[model samples]
Target chain A: MLDSERLATDSKPNILLKGTKEGLLLLLNEVVSFESLLEDLSTLIHGEKKSLFEGPDLKISVDYGERVFAASEIREILDCLAKRENLILREWGPSTAAKLSLFNSSRKFGPQTLLKGTVRAGQRPVFEGDVVVIGDVNPGAEIVASGDIYVLGRLRGIAHAGFLGDWSAIIAAAEFAPMQLRIADIVSRAPERDGKPLRTFMEFAYLKEDSMAVDKLDSLHAWTAMARQSS
Target chain B: MGTAIVVTSGKGGVGKTTSTANIGTALALLGKSVCLLDADIGLRNLDVVLGLENRIIYDIIDVISKDCKLEQALIRDKRFEHLTLLPAAQTKDKSILSPETVKELVGALKELHDFVIIDCPAGIELGFQMAVSGADRAIVVTTPETPAVRDADRVIGLLEKEGIRNPHLVVNRIRPQMVKRGEMLDIDEIVQVLAIDLLGIVPDDETIIKNANKGEPTVMKPDSKASLAYRNIARRILGESVPLLSFEEAPGFWGKMKKVFGAK
Candidate 1:
């Protein structure tokens, strides 16, 4: 838990502005609408623009709660922060306690099935726990796992991770060339390749903002929560 | 006891029958006793390909139904002294050959021959099941096309499930010129995609058509590239280390020298 010091006291303040050694910390209330929060943040910054700060340079750390932010939402926040002259948004993340709770939420329930051959066409392997395959999942094959799916080879088939609706479940592969990917209830289709081969060492798909998001292991920093906990 | 090897492809028109007849003939040519069994039942074609159709007085159904002795149904190939074929019944359905009957027939063939090569029908149906029922190993025949490769992958999966591990692959009808032009899948691409041990790559040659029409396998034409490829496949199946033939019959040395000198 951060030492959240409330700098403003509205009747029901959804945006908390706090003073830190580095910069101002903006702790957003998870229950409030993002539009209202952003509007409130803007009003507070400009309302006391003359007396609140001394220099033109400003640094901020936006702390989100249990809500998983989307890429668009993060971009929105960054855009809002750039509105201030000479501003640098240092970090944005969920509370440490929320992250810990998320880790504990998706626990291993049963033994994982480890397969060493290609899952071919017209074949589907449905497993209750983690499913790991050391071979390619060819097109027309479907693999459904209640937990995570780690394909050590090319994945050109359909993969459904957390099929029973566990949002924390992930699906990863060496070559992320799936026809379709699903994490929990969120589904994503593979983007049309531009006739150029993508050199993906390892990529994982997870639920982000009620949608399936795929990120390469190289660009792992974008997925702060997952990058923190090695899977 | 002889080893029963089933030549199969999940999709049709991928040269399963051609591979069977050629490889079986090649094995017999290598001084090994081989028995080729056509397990396609009503769609029988191995006998026609082997030119043994005119002498088919008793068929496999006659042997299975105890209407004739097993040796009575065997037809000796005229080209090879050690080669024999137990032809499939052209009129019967695939359901007549149960898994048990296939196993028993393969066992009986094993007692008399060094190699029993079964030509499995296309598609993973009852005919395919009966073909691979008693096999100790398998050879998956596939073309460079997407449908053939996809079905071959499925058949490989089924073979593994049946405890047939590491089935070899033969990519047939590969055109070196088309592969060079990047229009067709190469042998390496097919092997990589299927992730199986490659037995051989048979180049697309007109000799195959000629041999088939003449009721002789391409392996009979020793100078043909497809025949040499089949012989290499047979050698590999016999636990011999035979290097893969380079299907890169591109423009010859004279053409390369001409290009180097900028000669017309």
Candidate 2:
């Protein structure tokens, strides 16, 4: 075999998939490019299909050493792995010392999408998990997150949190005058306040007794505390 | 060495052909060599609107089918010395020309002209793809209405997806009276909904029909607001920062009195 082919088929592949107590830990070679790493990982999973996944389905966690990836890039890697039916991606993050502690504490955290600029009109950004927007959601834009949504700026567009019927998901923003808001299956329109100045305050929306309710975010800590007690 | 711009409106009758004609004429008037390609095959109207329909001996189909050279298909406009038109074949189907042919034709045209303005078809289909194939920039035209604005929004989204960044918007046929009466959507609302840079605003003018029927671009008429608007748009396209034209009419006696007295 050629030298490159020999290196490619070596026992210590670029992607190391080992069975661990925490299910499966996917350790990627930091030296390889991201694209090549993905290609090798795909080939490895497909090549070792029967023996590697002979038992029950298991969650696979990826540990990338010292490399930081954007939310979308990480999601793309996880999605590539998810195409294989035998593997379920539970979580993946940089294996920094700080994050390693969080990995040990909780392993059930799902994906989250973080968008930095204003979501403009005609732009629809959909996320599978929690979404955090650093800027405004202008009218004619829409954000659909399967989990909670937190916007650092004004929300004037359509925001659908708990899109998959998770009623506990909440929508929070610095300013909460949205054209239309939806939490799960329920839809609500912003009430018209003619001639009245809009309340310039932070607000959050959640389902209270099966009805959508908007509350001032000033008491957000108390609200979460109350919810913790109720749950 | 010329820029190719594709003028498109996802929904028809929002004035893509008219805008292309006027902008091309305006550019040619500014001493730039301009070629307007009518990409709306089987439904070509740019030639008719530009008043060069009778002068077309070889169409773009002839040029593409190798029956004629690219220069043979180009018809010179009598009004503007620098202006030229490549009329589409009315009898040919849109499928006759693929995106590759358009890219090749535009590449050739770019070497001969300062600007190659393509008039795209109505829908987001093969025709639209062919028109925008070699375009370095895009111009999306829409009227101040909900349906037009909605389609323009979709077109802008598609343009961005196709890697056409910063597609300029031309809100056409805006009625200032209806806007003041709150019956029609305003330019600001349309611009807000489209979320694109404002290129120009053409007021609803009967002169457009009169000039178009005469096979003349409205911009050639010195007194027409639509003409002035198109000129400003051409200037803007040439990297000149021109203030957006106001469509509002001068306040009348009662309006001026109300303004002076601070009355509603």
Candidate 3:
């Protein structure tokens, strides 16, 4: 085993390894050069300290403190960790105040489809990926998407997002008076009033736990925090 | 060279036949030769509404089957010199008429008339298809009710799918008093939901029922509100820009007193 104090003081190590309740946590220093960090990580995993990661099915999470890695650099780090057969890469991301962008991240969305006309009544537009409608969706129309749904106009019809059961998907519109909204497996209907005043600002609907919750577009921080914690 | 306009409403009793009779009469009154074709075969009522039921010796089925010439089956309107009526068969089912046969008949009629107005039957079945197959334009008639507007939306979607783009809308039987009290949908609301151009708006009036019962279209009675509305719609169809009729009701005695006291 390696001495933690000695490694911290000697040569100012760029990588630190700690055991957590979930599994192993690797914290990478942002100041060090990328090449040196990769070198140190490889040396630590393949050298004399390899016994720490030798356990069966140990999950490892990498937290890059205030550092953003390019796609190729992340691939290089993944290749270095792939050397250990028992270690599984669980989660890897930047841990900083800028993490609020996790909600706007495009990684979870599938291919997007752009529809340019109004979805009139009796029209059902189904897509395998995300769907973006540039016009109004009438009362009897329906839209089904496997990922997120974005409507630039009034959404007066039925919208089903995460059709294949992706719970994190969301439905958003400029005028959010939908006849019915479905996110993942949960469904919500409009209130029982014929004259519910139309909303002026943009609104969005998302799944909280087991039910659907609606909120204004300005309060996106709550969505970011919820998404980060759920994932 | 003539334009064929099909009047359609997916749901029943939204005044498809009444609109056809009145609009055709209004157009003929404007000095344009017009032909009214009733496509509701088993439920034929355009002739009765137009007061030409007694003059129909041969029906559209006779014309399609070559049992009679198209001119022989066409009944000249007793009131308007330029108006003609081709009544539907009383006993024949709507499924007997194919799209191709209706297209050929409309093509022949177009050669001799300035405008051919088709009265489409309720429901989006073969009758509706046959009526719309020969039209160059479409006028979707809908009331302000939700079911009627929903059905109109569905029919407009089908029309657009069949390559009839930008169909006009005519809101029929709107009561101005209910609309003023917010108890009924206004014209703007209906137009916004349907997302189509407004052709005209007909208010609900007792004169329309009386005129229909007398076998005279409401357009022939110039004193009624619906008659003026139909005239405006016909003028608009003739490429004239006519402002929409004001649906505001006259102020009551209390309202006039309040207005006199400078109350808004």
Candidate 4:
């Protein structure tokens, strides 16, 4: 019965597993108490036995072995291991079956994605790489980084992507409102806080013709390609 | 050593120039060597405020460009023996004074005077940067309003980023009676948000206007609250800890009856 819950079809520890259309969901499993379980699990994760918290962000679904512990304890152990490795844990909860829908559902393969959390007042997001946040960036928040930026929500805060002078950088969000936007050296600010709202499916923003431009996200690939070419 | 103090506010028209001019005159009247450098560039007014507009044979640009010597560009204050003015060039804006050039000017002036005061332009432009760049310390001036304090916080952040060692706050145009009623942003509130040291609190004083018109600074007056406040700031710059002065309404007779009767 335990092995049934344990989806260790591959030589992965199966601590964190989620089936994605792109690839097998895997995560670093470091909290297993038994030395042998840690070793076996480590081998399964990398195919070559190694310690946890190494490599890039991986999507993982927990394979509950026959010997089960409290759900909360598992979360806590994962959180502790993440903290030790300077990693941010994005949880798709294990308790409720609603979250399981996300576990079983197919997620699109992407280099990365923008988060959807609200950018509240006084909060800031400054990343060194590409960022795509799926939520609204509120007023008084700031986003500064050295790569491309995309916001699937309102880009109201001060967003400065490509601060290190990558002119090909872009900032696209669902809504086209932002207090100030900067791609490379070009800067633009929403003149009036009271701007018309956009109820749209998707939007794209990037440095175009020496300034910032907004367009449909579906049409992003062409210009983004051009942006890279011109640079 | 001479003190180079930059009076700045991130927002415009918060009495930065007025405070700098008055305090420069005040410190000079106390017999300290003082130089007031107006970094406002195109909007120069320290000369006008000091009533020395007619004596501008050479400007700060002349001194920096070495077109004329620093001594010739310096306008001597008529009233104070030790005070001098470095008027901003009428044609040039703040961009003319690069950070390196500004540091050189102030560093040179610091050797010759007891206080080298700079009048900063509003906002974080090249002028504001120049005004504060050569400062040994900074005096962040703010009014009892929201925009002023918010901008002041921005200035504080920039100053801290530039590695300015000591930054002090000066609460200007405070209406204490309103503060007592929660009608105004009190000194404590502004200080808390900026998280800086408080040098002094200046109340709204009518005599200040009269003094400005007469080309006199309140710092020379003994009993004036504004004068006392400036003096306190001066002493603080001199490495002395001074207590803040509060303006108490005349505690005498008719004041009480007027309050009780709600009289104007």
The most accurate candidate by lDDT is 3
**Model 1 lDDT tens row, A44-142:** 666555246447777767778776677897787777666666667776787633333444544656669998878887799999989999999998789
For candidate 2, lDDT tens digit of each residue in B1-264?
999999998999999999999999999989999999999988888999998888989999888888999988999999877799999998864455888988999999999999999999999888888998989999999998877877787777778778898899998998888988888887776765466789999898999999999998998987988999999999999999999888768889999999999999
The residue-by-residue lDDT of candidate 4 on B130-243, one tens digit each, is: 888899889889899978877786787677667785688888888778888877977875765566788888888888778777666767677778877888777777778877
lDDT of 4 at B155: 80
Tell me the lDDT of model 3 at A56. 91
Superposed model 2: Cα runs more than 4 Å off? A1-109, A116-124, A134-142, A151-157, A173-180, A185-203, B248-264
User: How large an RMSD does model 4 have?
Assistant: 14.1
Residue B216, model 4: Cα distance from true site in angstroms: 1.9
Return the lDDT, model 2, position A13. 69
DockQ of all predictions against the true structure, Cα-based: 0.43, 0.13, 0.57, 0.04
TM-score, ranked from best to worst = 3, 1, 2, 4
- Which residue segments of model 3 deviate by more than 4 Å? A1-104, B93-95, B250-264
lDDT of each: 0.84, 0.84, 0.89, 0.72
- Summarize candidate 3's per-residue lDDT along A43-148 as a digit string, tens digits: 8899878888887998888889788788999999999999888898777877622233333454556689999888989999898788899998999999999998
User: Which candidate has the top score in DockQ?
Assistant: 3
Better of 1 and 4 by lDDT: 1
What is the CAPRI rating of model 2's predicted complex?
A: incorrect
First chain TM-score for all predictions: 0.50, 0.52, 0.56, 0.46
Cα deviation of A176 in candidate 1 (Å)? 1.0
> Which pairs, if any, clash in model 3?
none
lDDT of each residue in B80-187, candidate 3, tens digit only:
877999999988544558999999999999988999999999999888899999999999999989999999999999999878998999999999889888899878
Model 1 bad stretches (over 4 Å): A1-111, A219-231, B93-95, B250-264
